[model samples]
Target: MLRSLCTPSLRLICKPTTRCRLYSTPAVPKKPNHALGVQNVKPWSELSTPQKVVVASKTTVNVGVILAGVALTGTIVYYIGSELFGSDSATSVFSDAVDKIRKHEELVAILGEPVKGHGEPSRNSRRRNRRITSQVVEDANNEPHMFMRFYVEGPENQGTVMLEMIKNEQKKWEYKQLYVDVPGQGLPSKRIYIERK
Candidate 1:
């Protein structure tokens, strides 16, 4: 049995293959290809007219959108700055009136010290969100006039301030009427005239 197994093993080991085929070709080294290489770019001069038009349109649209955004931002900033800090704006007028009210002896005595000014009252507890009501209208003489109303509060009492202004020939705001009305205090709702036309 050992001789038979050895004989078969020797024969198998000594056997040679009669048929064989080569499946691989010779190896050849090649340079790597980059997707974004300068060699891959097509110059503007080489582009067709239609392709050029498309590119031009895209650039114009992008620039137009950017310019529009900048203009809108500038307009909004100018409006807010002028409204809040301009010398002739309603907010400036309100601040000036409040200062005068604070200096008045009668109002200070009745309303107490450290008076605060704010917009109209609302249902919300946060008064900061309240907006001051104001309007611009033309009078019978076709002159522009502004009317505004707000509230002022102190430790003792609160009152509503009414103001009216007219645009003068020099394009300046001139106070026509300014007053504070304190109601429900068992006193006459006397319109305290702070300014006259």
Candidate 2:
């Protein structure tokens, strides 16, 4: 019985079986033809009238917008510069007032020599570039008047300076009032008359 079982199992194990197909093999990819795949771009002269017009209009609009933006930026900068740093602006008035204060015998004596003037003080360092407090308004006589205030400091003490000016018949700035107020200095704050109207 053992010989019979072994002989049959050995014959089945050693026998060759015919191959059967289940799935087909994938086809190889063809080489790309660069010359056939390339696209032909038309020249400017070959473009249609509508295409040329569209391109031209797009370029014109882009250039116009750029020029307009530049012009606007320049106008804004010029206006702001004239308003802030021009010879006839509020900043000019502030400079003149500070110069007068530096020369005044009373103020110089109280605040000490080499006095410096600046705008309002702030706790934040970035806000130190404060603008001068100023205003331009018309008076009852329809004459334009400018009012300004700023701070001044010296080796001895710090004080606040206030001033007012009017545009005269010649359109020139004329000082009406200028003064410095020093608190805790034990003296009356005297109004320094720069030029009496």
Candidate 3:
């Protein structure tokens, strides 16, 4: 067992072969000859002042172009996202409902009544608090419905005029109901009925 673990004799190890010369050579780095004249061989740190400035300027311009391209792409993405999600365009359901209500001759004539303090805001500026406020919600039938209230304070002092409109299959809005209570009187004077022809 001891003989099996021991190294072989020097006579067996001393055999001459091509493999013996592999380890005899020492690795040495070859020096580059300056006589061939490599044009860009000089390190950046060893370059003349003008040469270094030219390299640095080119690097700065390339970096600037890359940064500008990223900024422009980011700006385009932000604008597209804003227009897609944030705009109240005519195609939007809520905006369509509001536009229809605003253009209604009957509703506009009622709400557009000139109030006493309306022109007084901002020293006769037209930017008065609007009389109408509205919201849209889906009913039990999953149909779009608009609920709106108008504050009409004139000679009659009409408090809050409630209007409810539902969208039909023809892409048109029809009034569902309307309620307007008399200012001094406790109960509504009349009930509005919406009957389709």
Candidate that would win on TM-score: 2
Candidate maximizing lDDT? 1
lDDT of each: 0.80, 0.79, 0.52
47-151, model 1: which lDDT tens digit per residue?
Answer: 999989998999999999999999999999999999899988878988888998899878777778899988878887855667888899998989998899998
Which 10-residue window in model 2 sums to the lowest lDDT?
1-10
lDDT-superior candidate, 2 or 3: 2
For candidate 1, the TM-score is 0.68
Over 4 Å off, model 2? 1-41, 123-127
Per residue, candidate 3 scores C-alpha lDDT tens digits across 55-173 of 89999999999999999999999877754565332124334344544454444444454422121124445567543456778989899877765533444343344667777788566
For candidate 2, list the clashing residue pairs, or say none. none
Per-model TM values vs. the true structure: 0.68, 0.70, 0.33
Q: Local error of candidate 1 at 70, Å?
A: 1.7
Model 2, span 1-102: residue lDDT tens: 111113312322221354332333455576656789865557989999998998889999999999999999999999999978987987778888888888
Each model's backbone clash number:
0, 0, 0
